[model samples]
Target: PKRKTVEKHGRDLRDIIGQQQGKRALEIAAAGNHNLLFLGPPGTGKTMLASRLCDLLPEMSDEEAMETASVASLTQSEINEHNWKSRPFRSPHHSSSMAALVGGGSVPRPGEISLAHNGLLFLDEMPELDRKVLDSLREPLESGEIIISRAQGKTRFPARFQLVGALNPSPTGYYEGNQARTNPQAILRYLGRLSGPLLDRFD
Candidate 1:
Protein backbone atom coordinates (compact mmCIF):
# COMPACT_ATOMS: atom_id res chain seq x y z
CA PRO A 1 0.00 0.00 0.00
CA LYS A 2 1.61 3.28 -1.15
CA ARG A 3 -0.96 5.15 0.93
CA LYS A 4 0.51 7.70 3.34
CA THR A 5 0.08 7.19 7.05
CA VAL A 6 -2.59 9.21 8.92
CA GLU A 7 -1.55 12.73 9.78
CA LYS A 8 -2.08 14.42 13.09
CA HIS A 9 -1.42 17.66 11.15
CA GLY A 10 -0.45 19.45 14.40
CA ARG A 11 -3.83 18.59 15.92
CA ASP A 12 -6.23 15.74 16.60
CA LEU A 13 -10.06 15.69 16.66
CA ARG A 14 -10.00 14.99 20.41
CA ASP A 15 -8.04 18.14 21.20
CA ILE A 16 -10.58 20.50 19.65
CA ILE A 17 -13.28 18.38 21.30
CA GLY A 18 -11.44 17.64 24.54
CA GLN A 19 -13.29 15.66 27.17
CA GLN A 20 -13.96 12.02 28.01
CA GLN A 21 -17.53 12.34 26.77
CA GLY A 22 -16.47 14.06 23.58
CA LYS A 23 -13.86 11.38 22.95
CA ARG A 24 -16.55 8.75 23.23
CA ALA A 25 -18.82 10.83 21.02
CA LEU A 26 -16.14 10.96 18.35
CA GLU A 27 -15.84 7.21 18.60
CA ILE A 28 -19.53 6.79 17.82
CA ALA A 29 -19.49 9.27 14.96
CA ALA A 30 -16.48 7.60 13.37
CA ALA A 31 -18.59 4.49 13.11
CA GLY A 32 -20.85 6.58 10.78
CA ASN A 33 -24.06 5.74 12.61
CA HIS A 34 -24.76 8.56 15.02
CA ASN A 35 -26.03 12.16 15.02
CA LEU A 36 -24.67 14.98 17.20
CA LEU A 37 -25.40 18.59 18.08
CA PHE A 38 -22.97 21.08 19.61
CA LEU A 39 -24.40 23.76 21.88
CA GLY A 40 -21.91 26.57 22.28
CA PRO A 41 -21.11 30.20 21.50
CA PRO A 42 -19.05 31.56 18.60
CA GLY A 43 -15.33 30.83 18.00
CA THR A 44 -15.64 27.49 19.78
CA GLY A 45 -13.98 25.60 16.91
CA LYS A 46 -16.92 23.31 16.19
CA THR A 47 -16.31 23.44 12.46
CA MET A 48 -12.54 23.05 12.79
CA LEU A 49 -13.11 20.26 15.27
CA ALA A 50 -15.33 18.24 12.95
CA SER A 51 -12.98 18.93 10.05
CA ARG A 52 -10.18 17.07 11.80
CA LEU A 53 -12.13 13.81 11.73
CA CYS A 54 -11.04 13.32 8.14
CA ASP A 55 -7.44 12.99 9.30
CA LEU A 56 -8.44 10.37 11.82
CA LEU A 57 -10.71 8.26 9.62
CA PRO A 58 -8.92 5.23 8.12
CA GLU A 59 -9.19 6.26 4.45
CA MET A 60 -12.33 5.26 2.58
CA SER A 61 -12.55 1.95 0.69
CA ASP A 62 -12.92 1.93 -3.10
CA GLU A 63 -16.67 1.44 -3.12
CA GLU A 64 -17.29 3.85 -0.20
CA ALA A 65 -14.87 6.27 -1.78
CA MET A 66 -16.60 6.05 -5.14
CA GLU A 67 -20.08 6.57 -3.70
CA THR A 68 -18.83 9.62 -1.83
CA ALA A 69 -16.96 10.90 -4.87
CA SER A 70 -19.98 10.48 -7.12
CA VAL A 71 -22.13 12.63 -4.86
CA ALA A 72 -19.45 15.29 -4.65
CA SER A 73 -19.05 15.09 -8.42
CA LEU A 74 -22.71 15.92 -8.80
CA THR A 75 -21.79 19.29 -7.33
CA GLN A 76 -18.20 19.69 -8.52
CA SER A 77 -16.68 17.55 -11.26
CA GLU A 78 -13.08 18.14 -10.24
CA ILE A 79 -13.45 16.48 -6.82
CA ASN A 80 -14.67 13.31 -8.49
CA GLU A 81 -12.03 13.29 -11.23
CA HIS A 82 -9.30 12.42 -8.75
CA ASN A 83 -9.16 9.34 -6.54
CA TRP A 84 -10.47 10.59 -3.21
CA LYS A 85 -8.88 9.52 0.07
CA SER A 86 -11.21 10.97 2.70
CA ARG A 87 -14.94 11.20 3.25
CA PRO A 88 -16.96 14.21 2.09
CA PHE A 89 -17.72 17.24 4.27
CA ARG A 90 -20.74 19.52 3.75
CA SER A 91 -21.42 22.75 5.61
CA PRO A 92 -24.59 24.49 4.49
CA HIS A 93 -25.66 27.98 5.52
CA HIS A 94 -28.60 28.54 7.83
CA SER A 95 -30.65 30.43 5.27
CA SER A 96 -30.62 27.57 2.74
CA SER A 97 -34.02 26.15 1.76
CA MET A 98 -35.30 22.59 2.28
CA ALA A 99 -34.54 21.53 -1.28
CA ALA A 100 -31.00 22.86 -1.00
CA LEU A 101 -30.30 21.04 2.23
CA VAL A 102 -32.05 17.75 1.43
CA GLY A 103 -31.84 17.67 -2.40
CA GLY A 104 -34.61 18.39 -4.88
CA GLY A 105 -34.61 20.36 -8.10
CA SER A 106 -36.54 19.62 -11.31
CA VAL A 107 -33.61 17.52 -12.51
CA PRO A 108 -33.02 16.28 -8.91
CA ARG A 109 -29.44 17.14 -8.06
CA PRO A 110 -27.97 16.14 -4.70
CA GLY A 111 -28.03 18.83 -1.99
CA GLU A 112 -25.40 19.70 0.60
CA ILE A 113 -26.57 17.03 3.05
CA SER A 114 -26.75 14.37 0.36
CA LEU A 115 -23.41 15.45 -1.05
CA ALA A 116 -22.02 14.66 2.39
CA HIS A 117 -23.10 11.03 2.34
CA ASN A 118 -20.82 8.56 4.17
CA GLY A 119 -19.20 11.63 5.70
CA LEU A 120 -20.15 14.70 7.69
CA LEU A 121 -22.97 17.31 7.65
CA PHE A 122 -21.89 20.30 9.70
CA LEU A 123 -24.70 22.79 10.21
CA ASP A 124 -23.44 25.95 11.81
CA GLU A 125 -26.08 28.14 13.44
CA MET A 126 -28.49 25.25 13.36
CA PRO A 127 -31.25 27.19 15.08
CA GLU A 128 -31.01 30.01 12.60
CA LEU A 129 -32.07 27.58 9.87
CA ASP A 130 -35.68 27.76 8.69
CA ARG A 131 -38.07 25.65 10.76
CA LYS A 132 -39.45 23.86 7.74
CA VAL A 133 -35.97 23.11 6.49
CA LEU A 134 -34.74 21.94 9.87
CA ASP A 135 -37.84 19.80 10.25
CA SER A 136 -37.20 18.28 6.84
CA LEU A 137 -34.13 16.52 8.26
CA ARG A 138 -36.23 14.32 10.56
CA GLU A 139 -36.99 11.64 8.00
CA PRO A 140 -33.46 11.05 6.75
CA LEU A 141 -32.08 11.23 10.25
CA GLU A 142 -33.95 8.03 11.11
CA SER A 143 -33.77 6.11 7.81
CA GLY A 144 -30.08 6.79 7.18
CA GLU A 145 -31.21 7.78 3.68
CA ILE A 146 -33.11 10.57 1.96
CA ILE A 147 -35.95 10.19 -0.50
CA ILE A 148 -36.73 13.16 -2.65
CA SER A 149 -40.02 13.01 -4.52
CA ARG A 150 -40.38 15.47 -7.31
CA ALA A 151 -42.92 15.97 -10.06
CA GLN A 152 -40.60 14.07 -12.36
CA GLY A 153 -40.07 11.14 -10.01
CA LYS A 154 -38.57 10.07 -6.68
CA THR A 155 -34.85 9.75 -6.08
CA ARG A 156 -33.33 7.86 -3.16
CA PHE A 157 -29.85 8.81 -2.04
CA PRO A 158 -27.72 7.29 0.69
CA ALA A 159 -27.41 9.78 3.55
CA ARG A 160 -25.87 7.62 6.26
CA PHE A 161 -23.63 10.39 7.53
CA GLN A 162 -22.83 11.88 10.89
CA LEU A 163 -24.55 15.19 11.66
CA VAL A 164 -22.65 17.85 13.61
CA GLY A 165 -24.54 21.02 14.48
CA ALA A 166 -23.55 24.20 16.30
CA LEU A 167 -25.93 26.83 17.60
CA ASN A 168 -25.97 29.79 19.94
CA PRO A 169 -27.55 29.60 23.35
CA SER A 170 -29.56 32.69 22.52
CA PRO A 171 -30.79 34.08 19.25
CA THR A 172 -28.18 36.82 19.67
CA GLY A 173 -25.48 34.12 19.87
CA TYR A 174 -24.63 34.82 23.46
CA TYR A 175 -24.66 32.82 26.66
CA GLU A 176 -24.74 35.31 29.53
CA GLY A 177 -25.92 38.81 28.63
CA ASN A 178 -28.44 41.35 29.81
CA GLN A 179 -29.50 41.70 26.18
CA ALA A 180 -31.09 38.25 26.45
CA ARG A 181 -33.83 39.77 28.62
CA THR A 182 -34.81 42.18 25.91
CA ASN A 183 -34.53 39.53 23.20
CA PRO A 184 -36.37 36.76 25.02
CA GLN A 185 -38.90 36.36 22.22
CA ALA A 186 -36.20 35.98 19.61
CA ILE A 187 -34.62 33.05 21.46
CA LEU A 188 -37.93 31.27 21.89
CA ARG A 189 -38.86 31.78 18.25
CA TYR A 190 -35.55 30.43 17.07
CA LEU A 191 -35.66 27.33 19.26
CA GLY A 192 -39.36 26.83 18.57
CA ARG A 193 -38.47 25.50 15.17
CA LEU A 194 -37.23 22.23 16.64
CA SER A 195 -40.30 20.10 17.09
CA GLY A 196 -40.73 17.26 19.62
CA PRO A 197 -40.47 14.45 17.10
CA LEU A 198 -37.42 15.94 15.43
CA LEU A 199 -35.64 16.45 18.73
CA ASP A 200 -36.42 12.89 19.76
CA ARG A 201 -34.85 11.44 16.64
CA PHE A 202 -31.55 13.20 17.20
CA ASP A 203 -30.36 11.30 20.29
Candidate 2:
Protein backbone atom coordinates (compact mmCIF):
# COMPACT_ATOMS: atom_id res chain seq x y z
CA PRO A 1 0.00 0.00 0.00
CA LYS A 2 2.77 2.43 0.88
CA ARG A 3 4.57 1.63 -2.37
CA LYS A 4 1.42 2.25 -4.36
CA THR A 5 0.84 5.53 -2.58
CA VAL A 6 4.37 6.71 -3.29
CA GLU A 7 4.05 5.72 -6.94
CA LYS A 8 0.76 7.58 -7.23
CA HIS A 9 2.32 10.71 -5.69
CA GLY A 10 5.23 10.49 -8.13
CA ARG A 11 2.81 10.26 -11.04
CA ASP A 12 0.97 13.34 -9.80
CA LEU A 13 4.24 15.27 -9.46
CA ARG A 14 5.16 14.53 -13.07
CA ASP A 15 1.99 16.26 -14.24
CA ILE A 16 2.78 19.65 -12.67
CA ILE A 17 3.39 22.30 -15.34
CA GLY A 18 6.57 24.31 -15.84
CA GLN A 19 7.89 25.08 -12.38
CA GLN A 20 11.49 24.05 -12.71
CA GLN A 21 12.74 26.45 -10.05
CA GLY A 22 9.95 25.70 -7.62
CA LYS A 23 10.33 21.99 -8.22
CA ARG A 24 14.03 22.21 -7.55
CA ALA A 25 13.39 24.01 -4.29
CA LEU A 26 10.85 21.42 -3.25
CA GLU A 27 13.28 18.66 -4.02
CA ILE A 28 15.90 20.25 -1.79
CA ALA A 29 13.40 20.81 1.01
CA ALA A 30 12.30 17.19 0.84
CA ALA A 31 15.85 15.91 0.74
CA GLY A 32 17.23 18.05 3.54
CA ASN A 33 14.11 18.59 5.61
CA HIS A 34 14.54 22.35 5.32
CA ASN A 35 11.95 25.11 5.71
CA LEU A 36 11.15 27.25 2.66
CA LEU A 37 9.22 30.44 1.92
CA PHE A 38 7.88 31.23 -1.55
CA LEU A 39 7.30 34.93 -2.25
CA GLY A 40 5.30 35.98 -5.27
CA PRO A 41 1.96 37.38 -6.40
CA PRO A 42 -1.22 35.37 -6.05
CA GLY A 43 -2.08 32.93 -8.87
CA THR A 44 1.57 31.96 -9.03
CA GLY A 45 1.48 28.26 -8.19
CA LYS A 46 2.98 28.67 -4.78
CA THR A 47 0.30 26.63 -3.07
CA MET A 48 0.28 23.94 -5.72
CA LEU A 49 4.04 23.60 -5.68
CA ALA A 50 4.16 23.50 -1.92
CA SER A 51 1.61 20.69 -1.89
CA ARG A 52 3.78 18.59 -4.19
CA LEU A 53 6.59 18.15 -1.67
CA CYS A 54 4.94 15.00 -0.38
CA ASP A 55 5.72 13.29 -3.67
CA LEU A 56 9.46 13.63 -3.30
CA LEU A 57 9.51 12.73 0.37
CA PRO A 58 10.27 9.18 1.35
CA GLU A 59 7.72 6.97 3.02
CA MET A 60 7.44 6.98 6.81
CA SER A 61 8.90 4.09 8.75
CA ASP A 62 6.75 2.04 11.10
CA GLU A 63 7.76 4.02 14.20
CA GLU A 64 7.22 7.32 12.43
CA ALA A 65 3.86 6.16 11.11
CA MET A 66 2.74 5.17 14.59
CA GLU A 67 3.88 8.45 16.16
CA THR A 68 2.15 10.46 13.44
CA ALA A 69 -1.02 8.45 13.91
CA SER A 70 -0.97 9.07 17.65
CA VAL A 71 -0.90 12.83 17.10
CA ALA A 72 -3.86 12.58 14.73
CA SER A 73 -5.73 10.56 17.29
CA LEU A 74 -5.04 13.17 19.96
CA THR A 75 -6.44 15.89 17.70
CA GLN A 76 -9.48 13.80 16.69
CA SER A 77 -8.51 14.28 13.05
CA GLU A 78 -10.08 11.60 10.95
CA ILE A 79 -7.68 8.94 9.75
CA ASN A 80 -8.94 7.07 6.76
CA GLU A 81 -8.16 3.38 6.27
CA HIS A 82 -5.43 3.68 3.65
CA ASN A 83 -3.90 6.93 4.92
CA TRP A 84 -2.42 5.64 8.13
CA LYS A 85 1.11 5.53 6.75
CA SER A 86 0.79 8.45 4.39
CA ARG A 87 2.66 11.65 5.17
CA PRO A 88 0.49 14.39 6.70
CA PHE A 89 0.03 17.74 4.97
CA ARG A 90 -1.64 20.45 7.07
CA SER A 91 -2.61 23.91 5.83
CA PRO A 92 -4.61 25.94 8.27
CA HIS A 93 -6.44 29.10 7.19
CA HIS A 94 -4.84 32.53 7.59
CA SER A 95 -7.23 33.37 10.43
CA SER A 96 -5.88 30.54 12.60
CA SER A 97 -4.88 31.61 16.08
CA MET A 98 -1.64 30.83 17.93
CA ALA A 99 -3.41 28.03 19.74
CA ALA A 100 -4.73 26.63 16.48
CA LEU A 101 -1.26 26.58 14.97
CA VAL A 102 0.78 25.57 18.00
CA GLY A 103 -1.81 23.60 19.98
CA GLY A 104 -3.85 24.73 23.02
CA GLY A 105 -7.27 24.34 24.58
CA SER A 106 -9.00 23.58 27.89
CA VAL A 107 -7.89 19.99 27.52
CA PRO A 108 -5.03 20.60 25.05
CA ARG A 109 -4.96 18.92 21.65
CA PRO A 110 -2.55 18.56 18.76
CA GLY A 111 -2.65 21.54 16.37
CA GLU A 112 -1.83 21.71 12.68
CA ILE A 113 1.93 21.59 13.19
CA SER A 114 1.73 18.61 15.48
CA LEU A 115 -0.70 16.84 13.19
CA ALA A 116 1.88 17.33 10.43
CA HIS A 117 4.53 15.38 12.31
CA ASN A 118 6.97 13.56 10.02
CA GLY A 119 5.28 15.43 7.19
CA LEU A 120 4.67 18.95 5.85
CA LEU A 121 3.05 22.08 7.29
CA PHE A 122 2.19 24.45 4.46
CA LEU A 123 1.21 27.96 5.47
CA ASP A 124 -0.34 29.73 2.51
CA GLU A 125 -0.91 33.51 2.52
CA MET A 126 1.82 33.68 5.16
CA PRO A 127 1.65 37.43 5.54
CA GLU A 128 -2.07 37.42 6.21
CA LEU A 129 -1.48 35.43 9.41
CA ASP A 130 -1.35 37.42 12.65
CA ARG A 131 2.11 38.47 13.88
CA LYS A 132 1.80 36.63 17.16
CA VAL A 133 0.48 33.57 15.38
CA LEU A 134 3.41 33.60 12.99
CA ASP A 135 5.89 34.15 15.79
CA SER A 136 4.44 31.23 17.70
CA LEU A 137 5.91 28.89 15.08
CA ARG A 138 9.51 30.01 15.67
CA GLU A 139 10.07 27.81 18.69
CA PRO A 140 8.61 24.70 17.09
CA LEU A 141 10.51 25.30 13.88
CA GLU A 142 13.72 25.42 15.87
CA SER A 143 13.19 22.63 18.41
CA GLY A 144 11.15 20.40 16.12
CA GLU A 145 8.48 20.23 18.83
CA ILE A 146 5.69 22.21 20.51
CA ILE A 147 4.58 22.41 24.12
CA ILE A 148 1.03 23.40 24.94
CA SER A 149 0.47 24.39 28.54
CA ARG A 150 -3.01 24.60 29.95
CA ALA A 151 -4.71 24.67 33.33
CA GLN A 152 -4.81 20.91 33.23
CA GLY A 153 -1.17 20.27 32.42
CA LYS A 154 1.51 20.55 29.74
CA THR A 155 1.07 18.51 26.56
CA ARG A 156 3.99 17.97 24.22
CA PHE A 157 3.37 17.27 20.57
CA PRO A 158 5.84 16.29 17.87
CA ALA A 159 6.33 18.96 15.18
CA ARG A 160 9.35 17.72 13.30
CA PHE A 161 8.26 18.56 9.78
CA GLN A 162 9.29 20.73 6.88
CA LEU A 163 7.53 24.10 6.66
CA VAL A 164 6.47 25.53 3.30
CA GLY A 165 5.21 29.10 3.45
CA ALA A 166 3.66 31.02 0.56
CA LEU A 167 3.16 34.76 0.54
CA ASN A 168 2.67 37.75 -1.76
CA PRO A 169 5.51 40.17 -2.37
CA SER A 170 3.57 43.12 -1.04
CA PRO A 171 0.35 44.34 0.55
CA THR A 172 -1.53 44.59 -2.71
CA GLY A 173 -0.27 41.13 -3.71
CA TYR A 174 1.72 42.71 -6.53
CA TYR A 175 4.86 44.73 -6.85
CA GLU A 176 4.79 45.83 -10.51
CA GLY A 177 1.60 47.92 -10.68
CA ASN A 178 -1.52 49.03 -8.79
CA GLN A 179 0.36 51.77 -7.01
CA ALA A 180 -2.98 53.34 -6.02
CA ARG A 181 -3.87 50.30 -3.95
CA THR A 182 -0.61 50.12 -2.01
CA ASN A 183 2.49 52.10 -1.19
CA PRO A 184 5.99 51.44 0.19
CA GLN A 185 4.77 52.12 3.71
CA ALA A 186 1.84 49.74 3.32
CA ILE A 187 4.15 47.10 1.96
CA LEU A 188 6.48 47.51 4.91
CA ARG A 189 3.60 47.23 7.35
CA TYR A 190 2.23 44.16 5.59
CA LEU A 191 5.55 42.40 5.52
CA GLY A 192 6.14 43.36 9.13
CA ARG A 193 3.66 40.70 10.21
CA LEU A 194 6.43 38.21 9.59
CA SER A 195 8.83 39.23 12.32
CA GLY A 196 12.60 39.26 11.74
CA PRO A 197 13.20 36.41 14.18
CA LEU A 198 10.50 34.22 12.63
CA LEU A 199 11.71 34.96 9.12
CA ASP A 200 15.22 34.02 10.14
CA ARG A 201 14.09 30.43 10.79
CA PHE A 202 13.26 29.70 7.15
CA ASP A 203 15.98 28.53 4.79
Candidate 1 lDDT, tens digit per residue, 4-46? 6553333465455355565566666666655777676677656
Looking at model 1, residue 163 earns an lDDT score of: 78
User: Estimated TM-score per prediction?
Assistant: 0.81, 0.91
Q: 80 in model 2: Cα distance from truth in Å?
A: 3.4
List candidate 1 segments past 4 Å from native.
1-11, 14-24, 80-83, 182-185
Which whole-number lDDT from 0 to 100 does residue 116 have in model 1?
78
Model 2: per-residue lDDT, tens digit, 39-147?
Answer: 9888888998988888678778889999998888886788755656678889999999888888888878878999889999999999889888888888888898998
Please list the C-alpha lDDT of all candidates, in the order they appear. 0.73, 0.85
The C-alpha RMSD of each candidate to the native structure, in angstroms, is 3.1, 2.6
Measured with C-alpha atoms, the lDDT of residue 61 in candidate 2 is 88
Best by TM-score: 2
